[model samples]
Target: MKANQPMVKVISSGKYAPSTLITNEDLERLVDTSDEWIVTRTGIKTRHRAVDETTSDMAYKAAMEAINRVNYDKDKIDLIIMATITGDQMTPATANFVQAKLGLNHEVMSFDINAACTGFVYALETAASLLQTGRFRAALVIGGEQLTKIVDYTDRNTCVLFGDGAGAMILEPSTHERNQAFFFNAARGDTNNTLTVVNHIKMDGKRVYLFAIDAMEQAIRKVLESSGLAIEDIDVIIPHQANERIIQSVSKSMGIPMDKFMLNLSEYGNTSAASIPITIAEYYDQNEVKNKKILLVAFGGGFTWGSAILQL
Candidate 1:
């Protein structure tokens, strides 16, 4: 590795989902939806729900798992960046609560970012930028959401589309030749009320679907272009586990094979910020990603969307 090259590499990843499983059949009792309808449209059969667990609790669990994966030194972690739309509290940042729960006594910079489903990608980019400054050695980037808390169960449209979960990752300076990661994040303020969560989750399903497809395609192309890499060069693409239809559309539009995308929404639902990182953690746990190039793309409610290319 060159001495002047500043590279932020992911060291480990972890994820946590609640024990309570809400199956499509279960939704039939609460709403007017059926297993066949949801399965055919969203590819979701079941989703985990946080009955009593807070967002910070899930975040802490995921973070601990990532730290334990490598027996990482907690003292070396100087930063914690958590991404979520449904935090435990509105006063102190959710990251602060996680830091405390982890028993970190050091003075670490802990904060939270809210970009809805695209939050994990935004947080990853932010952590990489701060790590490249050469001041922080290791940092924890987490995405946790108790999204079921905000979903209006009375409305079948939004109710069937969300769940609760968390995922985390540890990042450190890299010495490998191909350890750098590239990112492209952009968002347009939502004025049309296509997607919003004021009193409860509300969205124009058709409008949001159109926006998601376009955003994913553009974000993927932008990141690959910036990294000077071709589509075939990517080993895996982990997109936000929003809807199966969006992923299918992007696959068709980009001429990319569906096998290249890591998908688990069928089991976890739309976990918002937690989706991509959770998918990543599960993928790394199941596959050999030692020197692979992974692409991540996400689109969410703030009209937020982003893409990232990371070399493992």
Candidate 2:
């Protein structure tokens, strides 16, 4: 069999959501919003809040679970790529903190990437590519965020739409044809600043909605085409849990069924970079996933969007 460019197999997966819950009813007190309105609009009922935890904390917790699930040797993880907008600090990359928490005192290639909500897809592609180089054996890919720290409670539109959590996957290069991976990551710059997170998150909801639908559709189609796989070939699609409406629109437009997409935004709202991996971890937890071909798609703040097709 021919070797693929981005070929990495998942050894284990895990996720960490803070215990604290922020329900729509709780948001009604913070801003001018109702449970019915929030649910009808975003399909989100509640989101997790990391009260005392930082992004790196959630990342470490999630990574530990993934490692322990298979009892994988910590030394095998020679590469660590974390995708997040919120880090514990400015200088030390969040991946560094996660590497420390994982107790890897040895030299490991670790770093962080911020492509916003589509970050996990970007990081997955990066790690997969790096693993193919034969320099790294196993890679820890994580998507984590503490979005609430950067959200403004006064803004009803953005405030109710984010949460805090982390998800991780342990991957290693695989020569097996079944484990071949394909990805497409691209971005359209937000010149108008349709969505921006400087001190806090600010967004034009209408513009983002329109862009998300188009971007997600493009990514899904591109990855499928590049992988030579049709929609039916995919067992499930793990889309960014940003909005149920956006997923629904993509489903309807693409002639794909809604049930084919894994959704958990009702329990955890847009976790920024963490959404896709969290959905992937939760999906694996609920189902028997083996040799399953999955498609991941996401659209984010950089006007960034990407997709990946891989087998489990």
Candidate 3:
């Protein structure tokens, strides 16, 4: 980051997954895939379903969790950026619904970003940039998805790979230099429609797998280079919970240890944009990450990929 730019600090994070869960066994009855196959391939045992909850509902709950963590002043939050392809509706952005749910009946700048699984990182970078302008105070950055609503249960290829959940982070511009943030978010056009959602989710598994490994590795390297930090300088890495194989591949190719990556996909599957933030929330719950240098990386549909390095 430039010296003239404002710094942003992440105050808190929270995540929410609905009560309904679809296990691998449940999928076995619905499709031809079995428990062992699903587990061995995706490293996902079960994925949560929204049931009656909408995308905005999960987003609101997640934002509330972060707000209540420090009893943050809701009125101070003037910006809300949500990431979700499975929104409640198309007219009003999902972030608007989240703002209403927060009871912030004020002039808040709110919107949504559809960068697929890389949505959270994109939203975070956008929020930080806006905050750096000194135009916004506290901001809510959320990644929520109801992918189950769009997933085709009959298609074994994509049916076992998604879930519904939301994760939120509260950020504010900081004067402390230690609170600086660095990010890289970009995408490659997908003319082939390798991974897409049109009424229902569809994907070419082999193509996506190949793209994911390369995209994630590049993003990680770019962000680390931008920050002039080596992999050892990062206390932990939170990667998009897309597939275990992709992450393992990046780790091996980069020579980074598996333990350095914070992973929880075994329980949540791929929550699209919600994966990274949800894993971050869970990791914070289990570990002391004070003053830690954390790296976040992701790749998704749109052939989008990016990374961020944050001091927390």
lDDT of 1 by residue, 240-279 (tens): 9989999999999889999999999999999999999899
> Which portions of model 2 show Cα errors greater than 4 Å?
1-4
RMSD of 1: 1.7
Q: Local error of candidate 2 at 65, Å?
A: 1.2
TM-score, cand. 1 vs. native: 0.97
Q: What's each prediction's clash count?
A: 0, 0, 0
CA lDDT, candidate 3, residue 171? 94
Give per-residue CA lDDT, model 3, range 172-193, as digits (tens): 9988888888888899899999
Candidate 1 steric clashes: 0
lDDT, model 2, position 277: 89
C-alpha lDDT (0 to 100) for residue 16 of candidate 3: 97
What are the models' TM-scores? 0.97, 0.98, 0.98
Say which prediction, candidate 1 or candidate 2, comes out ahead on lDDT.
2
